[model samples]
Target: MLKKYKDDQEFYSLVGIKPQTFYKMLEILKIAESKQKYYGGRKNKIVIEGRLLMTL
Candidate 1:
């Protein structure tokens, strides 16, 4: 679904943020996720980018 948006304007219109900003936010999430210890629970099946998009 992410790959479907090729134009910058279209992507921004759908997501309400610049693609660069999205990637930056994703990087931050990845770092934060990496530092966290695993707890006993169902793990997320969705990729980080999808989760961020859902939040947006």
Candidate 2:
């Protein structure tokens, strides 16, 4: 089964990650976006839509 998350809170609930860690991961993904100039890989990408995070 797969689910799409609408916020950090929803993602946390679905993945069972702690609030602190969830926010940290979101922060890291945001930072990595700026550093991804030549990098291209499906696994390394962060998929956030509006407040939604897509996962499979």
Where does model 1 exceed 4 Å of error?
A: 37-42
Worst 10 residues of 2 by lDDT: 47-56
Candidate models: Cα lDDT each:
0.84, 0.56
lDDT of 1 by residue, 1-56 (tens): 36777788999999999999998999999988876635445567998889999999
TM-score of each: 0.80, 0.42
Worst 10 residues of 1 by lDDT: 34-43
Candidate 2 lDDT by residue in tens digits, 1-56: 22445776876676677556756667876676657734764543434422324431
Best by lDDT: 1
